[model samples]
Target chain A: MPVWQRIYEEINDPGFVILCAAQDTGGEAAAGPIFDAANATFIQVVDPDHIISSAFNFVNVPSAAWVDEQGKIVRIDEGTYSKLHELGEGDTKISFGTDVYSVALKDWVAKGSDSAYVQSAKTVTGNIRQHSSDQLKADAAFRLGNLFRTHGYADKAEHYWDLARSLNPDSVNFIRQNLTLSEEGSAGETFRDLMGDYVKSGKDYYRPLDIQSPLQPKDEDR
Target chain B: MAKAMMAYPELRHPFAEKPIHAEGSTTVLYQGRSITLARTGAGAGLLIQPDDLPGINGFTLKPEGACYEDLCVPIGANLLVDQQGEQWFDLTGFADLLGQPYVADSEQRVWSFAEIPAKRDGMMLDAMAPDFKVTDREAQVVSMADLKGKKALIVTWSSW
Candidate 1:
């Protein structure tokens, strides 16, 4: 976010803007600090209900949708975040779509449609799919669990959240949040540890992004 | 008792800004003005007045059925709640009738309803973005329409 804020600050005067829809179910009080700390003043909002995620078909956070000036979506839920560098000191580290995404974003802002980064409409629609029935079910479970968890109903929260996890096991967010809801469900481990376990178990939690000429015809057609 | 809990700072979670339940029989706070739900008899479902249907779940009854946008769940009087001749829709029964998944905890007095799977069937693989609304830090509501004229890069992320 801080990374995008820097880019947003740099080019916003030219009509290049960044808007954020935070996925914190707790809404503003919980999610505002990061925006503030990053000095991101451009239109910031929160999606406690995960509306944007379900609508755009993006499952994870740090995902982005690029819409052109004409209100057409140029790209929906592509790899965001500046994968430019390691996040922490030494062993405690993180890698994101830093330089690649930043360079691509700037190219779009500077060049618009002429930029090679824009995607074809067919490819855009093709990338999304009818999420499995379980995933749709998971959305409801997450909604219910989020409500209970926010209201201090620990056990009730666990019931639905655990249901969410079972319904959509790849959602690490659900697992981390559920672990805190009940002792029986608790892992008392960090997100890194649990995310590692998910990886070991062969859950494709992180999406590998291929953003080059995303609009071009599929290889089969060409 | 829930209100009383909200009144006490120590009783409330230090970070939460809103109460779970409002101070009347007409509301359960999850979003917006909250939903109007009444406990009808010793049952597993919630009863919402037909006139208040839209606010409760965005379902509007028409000549055909309980319609949402272009989709409708065909319902009849059989699904209506009855208490001394006054009637409302049985939320659970309506969902069950439509074959949609839902969960209600009578003990917690809370429930959740999911979108009909058919909606996803229609929505999946569509290129157009689904319209959604959210609030800024100042509590002002913003919708997709508000950003109509400009190029937008919408990022969905979290602090945790």
Candidate 2:
């Protein structure tokens, strides 16, 4: 929330708006305190059932889709950074995305649709892959699990979560939320155990935007 | 005000009550609707009763195809797989062929289906944003339509 608030403040004049859709199935009761405490001035829409995730074809949170002033999705990346990264920040393992995302976001806001970050329609569509059969099933399972978990049926929730994790073994996002709920508000040791495996696997785990692609630079085009 | 779900602990499908089961048959709830899966008389292959096939997944078995209105996807002999001279429709396998996604917990006998994306073939940018209603911090209802014509940097996030 701090990161977003900073970005929103930086580029609000250029018609840049940040709409944070909190995907908490527990509704406001679960997500309210965090945003309320943040004193966020930007738009905060509580996504009760994850309608945005299902529509955007993204499975996890902290994932952002860049929409242009015309309302077309310009870019969608998982590891969207709020601040430019500094040296040793990677070692701290605190920030998610690199400095490139913020740079690109500002470029888009300043240049409008003409920004090189604005991908072609074909490219955008091609980049957006539909969820695989298993992933789709996992989405449903996770939804069902979330419903049960929030309703005090931890045992029942665990059953569905096991099925979801089995079907989409790589989905740490789904697994993390479930574990956090059961572990009395902390992801705890289960998160560490899962992270160990996740790191060893070394898949495209974060799914960051391809930063190497050239975008308009302030001085000249890269 | 929406009552907390736990306030109604007894909530369940009306048909979720105990039902008579055929010999050697297992029950699975499809979309919260109960249906029995019976094993083929020959080698073990699962089949939904012909009469109950429509209820299984809303596919009306038509000679033309798995007819749902005018759209009939021809599953052909592929629809019914034969194992050891006994024909049975493999529910799991059929779902894969249709590109429909489903989640099943065999132990709990629950199967859930998800909607197939209608616009995946390269119209994402041109496609209009899907509208949805959600509540603000004050619990007042708001919707995507309320912000029409404005660009939104939609962020999907979790507090954890």
Candidate 3:
């Protein structure tokens, strides 16, 4: 069963509405299942040119902003829905006790902005993220890496990607794509061997490869 | 006036050190140490650095009053006046006369007068934080300023 089908079945309630705002970059194909499964009205705003992203300063995907019926914003949070039953539980455990989405959603439905839990303007002003010089440099490197990748120079792409990762180690896409690319080469024989060593040592680089076998036994035999 | 013929019993050197006492009207003291105390009209000490002759240098308090040592002038409600005929308070003169600067404690409260070296300028307290705006799926602006008069909380994150 597709992910969208599952989501459609889950949010069948009449009053519930799921709004998915996606940047039309790389992840839309992965998000297609969920968007299709939504039973409520779905709004897809695609920034194929990334103009909206630049205007909104969106650095990552699935970021959402909640607004009231009057079009006034009430909350903004990252959105992620997975098919795994334990996904929500795992997210709760990892988010350091700050499950803002569930709590804020309930509050918005119950009391609107009049909720005592809502934050004041001053607090919001003090908490916003400002772009630093380091982040700007990382962005430049990441863009250069993308250009290299698109222009048929994988090695140059990898170089810029490495620079980007070093500059901003916290970037999830940078880490994920780099590792995934490393694993995909030559049926991931090298990646699987590395994974075997890591497993033997009780260390984990990332989620284990769940697809077909990563090892090329013929190459080893040769 | 209770007068006592204080003797230089210890053979105090002219330029070494001198003890200061408050007298009723007339003040008679040794001059070799190059210390002057002025009674400013506002009753604040105005200590002047010896290097800079004339300017509102710094402030200090002494047994006599506030004094500007650069001009070697005594300032008070009636003694001295500014060019505009306004009463002057010269604390720089008082320090130049006192030959020492007032020291302040960790809490920025004044402690005692001591010959202290000048300090380098302190680090700036201002810091630049990451500033960004959040918007909804519709590209609507959601700024912190919009939340004024209402309570709100911001959760920073990304959904890669």
Indicate which candidate wins on lDDT.
Answer: 1
Local distance difference test, candidate 1? 0.63
Candidate 1: docking tier: acceptable
Report the C-alpha lDDT of model 2 over A140-160, residue by residue, as the tens digit: 676565544544556666677
Query: Which portions of model 3 show Cα errors greater than 4 Å?
Result: A1-25, A37-41, A45-64, A67-100, A180-222, B1-160
Provide TM-scores for the models: 0.78, 0.64, 0.36
Residue-level lDDT of model 3, residues A96-175, one tens digit each, is 22223344444445576565434333332222233343443454455444433443445555666677667654343344
Docking class of 2: incorrect
Per-residue C-alpha lDDT of model 2 across residues B1-160, encoded as one tens digit per residue: 5443222222221122232346566654333234656643332334554556676666677777676544566775755765666556666555666676765544444455554443233235463444445556665665555654555677777666
Backbone clash total, candidate 3: 26
What C-alpha lDDT do the candidate models reach, one value each?
A: 0.63, 0.60, 0.34
Clashing pairs in 1: A82-A98, A83-A96, A83-A97, A83-A98, A84-A98, A84-A99, A119-A215, A120-A215
What lDDT score is found at residue A148 in candidate 2?
49
Candidate whose DockQ is highest: 1
- Arranged by TM-score with the best first, the candidates are 1, 2, 3
TM-score of chain B of 3: 0.20
TM-scores of chain A across the candidates, in order, are: 0.79, 0.78, 0.50
